[model samples]
Target: MLETYCNASGQRVNNEKSSIFFSKGCPQVTRDGIKNTLQVHDEQLSDRYLGMPTDVGQAKNGTFKYLKDRVWEKIK
Candidate 1:
């Protein structure tokens, strides 16, 4: 589950170096083709994509399993 927020306003407002609006919830994982439909909020923001968790461990608990699996596979 990955969450992303965009700043549609393009005001170049510095949200304290934070690009995301708010993403503390689990994001639904769907096929690439269905991703567009799942994005219910099409509201444009000022920035592009930002504020995503770079580390797998930092992700939500529910999404941790998937991240771990990928990491383990890479180690093999």
Candidate 2:
């Protein structure tokens, strides 16, 4: 699927900045197979994306505290 897209679009994925994310329940063997098949590197997702938290946890306040800080800073 990716191959066809890249072929038709004349654009290829930048492997350097590419990563494959798998569910927590996904087995290591399956993850390895999928990564090998996709020819993409396996990397842990960053805690934040575009300056925002990517995964919200039980502690919502902590996850979003940065926004409050930013707001206060801007207000000041």
Best by TM-score: 2
Worst 10 residues of 1 by lDDT: 40-49
Q: Once model 2 is optimally superposed onto the true structure by TM-score, how far is the C-alpha of residue 59 displaced, in angstroms?
A: 2.3
**Model 1 lDDT at residue 54:** 48
Question: What's the lDDT for all of these models?
Answer: 0.43, 0.86
- Clash number for every model? 9, 0
As a whole number from 0 to 100, the lDDT of residue 7 in candidate 2 is 100
lDDT of 1 by residue, 3-76 (tens): 22335543543334433222445254433324344443332234223433444345467545665778899999
Question: CA lDDT of 2 in candidate 1?
Answer: 30
The superposed Cα distance between candidate 1 and the true structure at residue 49, in angstroms, equals: 6.2
Candidate 1 stretches greater than 4 Å from native = 1-59
